[model samples]
Target: MNVGIETGPVRTGGYASSPERSGLAKFVSDTSAVFVREILLLLRDPMTLIFSLLQPLVFLALFGPLLTGALGQGSTAETLQWFVPGVIVMISLFGTSMTGSNLLYELMTGSYERILATPLSRSSLLVGRALKEFAPLVVQGLLIVVLCVPFGFILHPLHLLAGLVVLGIFGIGVGALSCALALAAQNREWLFWTVQQTVLFPLLILSGMMLPLDTGPGWMRTVALFNPLTYIVDLERALLGGSFTDPDVLQGVAAAVATCAVGLVVGIRRTRRTA
Candidate 1:
């Protein structure tokens, strides 16, 4: 006779125990789901992306000639070679920096709260939304580049690719920071727009995205040094110019990485607490 031993019952169908996903796997899955949802929304309402191109196009057409005339040294193509990179940066900045508004709208409509009720990690929510900005930014950048090519702007495939990578990295940070700001101003939407516009223009001008800082006053030059966008603009110029060995590239990479780190940290923390 054997000692009495009981066997456990096996669960069936949906009640069966399955292997739990690892942390990394779960995060990736959740992020992808959120990203796909965002893409769907973008496809449904594409006007925002289309309208975003207008400002950059206007700048390229109207201001580009003026820039060449003012400089009085370079050909139109040479001016565009320098100018187009800044325009790409502008595309990234304008496109990504305002992404928080969508989040803010969702918050007001309670859609975001519904999403928050899901099991998705807060980090994934922020990250997925930030990743959505990359598509539109890349599209705008490419369109601008292609449009400029006929005007004498040289096109280097590798350099443009590298520049897009930098722009994508920088856009991630700006977008995350924007979402964090939206969370902060969830109740006061005007404050979000006010702060965004107030800060964005100064950064744009100070970075010499439209005009060179060489002729600017010393104080303007000093302030530009502190703006992360300045490095990005410079780095884009260097890369497009085929100055592969330029030190600004390193500086730009460092700046973009730092911005991404800071933005993600702040966005995730705020979302965790607020949502």
Candidate 2:
């Protein structure tokens, strides 16, 4: 009766069966999952995406021609070279600024709270949402640029890609901040709307995304100095114009990075509190 050592490999639970992911790896995985979820949601709403793009295209088609005369750049191509960057920035601004509203809607439906109940990282919720904005932004920007090409906009592949990268970074910050605002105004929807509208137009005008700040009144020029978007717009124009070595490029990069840092800090902290 040799009931000899019948010890088979001991069974282990899930955690012991697999090595735990490192902190950074876990974060990356969580963020990627959230990003994919957001993108899938976005894809389901094709009409919203189409409508979101219409305003920018209308601006290019109607306002673009007017800008040629206004800037007196001597050619439609030259004018577009200058105006296109601003329009793309405009898309980034408008597109990301309202991201909070989506979060707010989710809150109303209790989906946001349900998501927070999961084991997913809170910071990833905000970051992944912000990152999701980048795809539509890039697509809308590329389409706008392509349309402009027929109207004389020069296309430098590398420069265009780089400029979009910069815009995407800036947009992440804006989107994150928007998410934080959503968290703050979770109960007061009107507060979010009020604050968003109040802040957004000023940033747009002050950034000189639609007009040059060079000839603005003394006080306006001084005010523009405090607006980070001004530097980014200047940098975008410079990069798209093949002026990569321009001095303002450094400032723009710094501004984009700073915005991203601050927004992430605020957004992540707010998200954790919600959890």
Candidate 3:
């Protein structure tokens, strides 16, 4: 039986479907409405969006010329081919890692509880947030890649697709994990950051975002082998060079999928329980 109500939406205007709507249809509508709301909230203060890009931009400005030039041995093109993808990942890392703070803020302000009272599936809320992050990150990654063109960075169609795919997987996983952490921690802000910084910095460094690992110490390379970001970075470099059939790319994609799936499931489960 189609069990949706024909009632007015308490929030997310007109999001609630008619009373006769199917479960799947209602869920889709709710998720979409939630996604729109999230986007609108993000857009309301465009400065936030600009600031979000600031860190990566600063990193690129301060570090790009020096490191990329040195790394590529004066070949600016090769430098960007290595640097751009790492910048993308670094952006995702900073942006999504702190999503839990938003949730915590909502919870403290009673907004989250009100949202919980809505008839929409809790997973829709979580998924909507994930989609929100995914969209911008993709655009940001693309824009950065495009802007690098004048500097001699070459772009491949397949590389762009694969890079976006990898970043989407990374964003969703990180976003889901953020949500789960927020739910679990509730109002404990410090705990979230403590764990986040500990985990995040290691991943970023292990990824060798600023330096090539090929000449690094044996043990460091061995340690990086265990990090999923390392493989993703490897795939990005491969894609930058217009090669996609490498085994490492496949491994990286598989790792990304697994990580995203698991985090989403865990987050969805936690949100359901909270509801």
Q: Best-fitting candidate, measured by TM-score?
A: 1
Model 3 poorest 10 in a row by lDDT: 8-17
Give the per-residue lDDT of model 1 (tens digit) for 29-105.
Answer: 77888888999999999988987889988998899889988877479998898899999899899889999999989
Residue range 81-165, candidate 3, lDDT tens digits = 7788888888887888777778888988998887877677888888878777887787788878878888898889778887787
Locate the minimum summed-lDDT window of 10 residues in model 1. 9-18
In order of listing, the candidates' clash counts read 0, 0, 0
Q: After superposition, how far is residue 233 of candidate 1 from its true place, in Å?
A: 0.3
Task: Point to the candidate with the largest lDDT.
Answer: 1
**Candidate closer to the true structure by TM-score (higher is better), 2 or 3:** 2
Ranking by lDDT: 1, 2, 3
* TM-score of each predicted structure versus truth: 0.92, 0.91, 0.90
Q: Write down the TM-score for model 2.
A: 0.91
Q: C-alpha displacement of 213 in model 2, angstroms?
A: 1.6
**What does the lDDT come to for candidate 2?**
0.87
